[model samples]
Target: MHHILFFGDSLTAGYGLKNAKTESLPALVQQKIDADKLPYHVINGGLSGDTSAGGLFRLDYWLNRPIHVFVLELGINDIIRGISPQTTYKNLQAIIDQVKQKYPTVKLALMGMEIPAFVPGSFAAEFRTIFRKLADANQMAFVPFYLAGVAGKPHLNLPDMLHPSAEGYRIIADNVWPVLHGLL
Candidate 1:
């Protein structure tokens, strides 16, 4: 089976879920793939509270096997910690670079985050546009703001108002599936 790795932070990890294996985006995508009788094998390389730099550091370990698709969902944690957008961009770019070096033929997909245009500071704008910039530069399939219908919807999120609940994840998966399916 071809391997597709979903790598990122809390959202990818299914943070508040009782079971990531069955509820995470990767798992949900796997279910969709299975229903379609696809040969892709999904791998969840999600780590809670991880940042772009952290992902870069942990990348090599996950590179042990050949990967057909590599979906990157990191960076929000870095932004939450007030890291510079440029630094996060470079870090994510580095991760992309490493993955490309290891699996030259791997298809790439980037899951981006966005802040409202009204949010103050050049930081918000810069951070909001990083994924687009990266996607354009690298020719990766892009999920522009995967949290669209789920974010800020109280019922969609866990009590903490951060991570998505089980239903929220379903929505996320639906949002991601099309772009991901295209890569396959």
Candidate 2:
């Protein structure tokens, strides 16, 4: 069976959800696949507060099985932690390289994140460019901003105002589906 791996941080993990299995972006995408009668299984590889380095460190474990489509959504934690954008880029590149090296034909998608407006514009710009640059360089599908419709909307986000709520995740799934469908 084909597997679509949603690999990233809490955003992809459906953080604060009462039922992540059914409420997460991966699961929502899986539902779409099911409705369309597609033969694919969605796997959520999200870890709360995970950085690009952490993703690289744990990638090997997930690579054991065939990954038909890889939706990469890391680096937000790196930005939040004030990690250098250069290091974040390098770690993300390493992760992408490892995936391609292991599964040459797997379809890849890069999900971009945006830092809060409070962050310095220059730093945020550099951070935001990482995903697009990686996607362009690697020839992967790119989602410009993962939190497009959900970010900064009080109703869409949880009390923390960072992670999405269940409805917010649904909107996120919507934002992701078109890109993922094109890849499929």
Candidate 3:
């Protein structure tokens, strides 16, 4: 079976959701795929609080199987933790490189995240450019901003303002569906 792996941090992991298995982004995507009778299995490779560095370290474990589509959604935690944008970029690039090496035919999709306005303007801009740069370099599908419509909207996010609520995830799923659908 072909697999579509949603690899990322808490946002992709559905951190604040009460029913992650059914409400997480990946699960929601799977539901759509199933409705359309697509032959694909959705795997959630999200780890809460994980950074780009952490993702790089754990990538091998998730690479053991054949992956048809790889949806990369990391780097937010690194940005939030005040990690250097260069380091995050390098780690993310390495992860993409490794995935390509292991699964040459895998279709790639990058989910971009934005740093809050509180972050330094230069750093935030640099961080924002990384995902698009990577996507362009690799000729992969890209989502300009993963939290475009959901971020900063209290009704769409949990109390902490970081993680998305179930309703928010639904919005995310809607945003991601078109990108993934084209790949499928």
Structural similarity to truth (TM-score) of each candidate = 0.98, 0.97, 0.97
Each model's lDDT: 0.95, 0.92, 0.92
Weakest lDDT window of 10 consecutive positions for candidate 1: 112-121
Backbone clashes in model 2, listed as residue pairs? none
What clash pairs does model 1 have? none
In the range 55-106, model 2's lDDT, one tens digit per residue, is 9999999999999999999988998899988999999999989999999999
- Report the Cα lDDT for candidate 1: 0.95
* Predicted structure with the largest lDDT when compared to the true one: 1
- TM-score of candidate 2 relative to the true fold: 0.97
lDDT of 1 by residue, 125-170 (tens): 8999999999999999999997989988999999997899899999
Q: Please, what's the RMSD in Å of model 1?
A: 0.8
Off by over 4 Å in 2: none
Give lDDT tens digits, candidate 3, residues 84-118: 88999899999999999998999999998877668
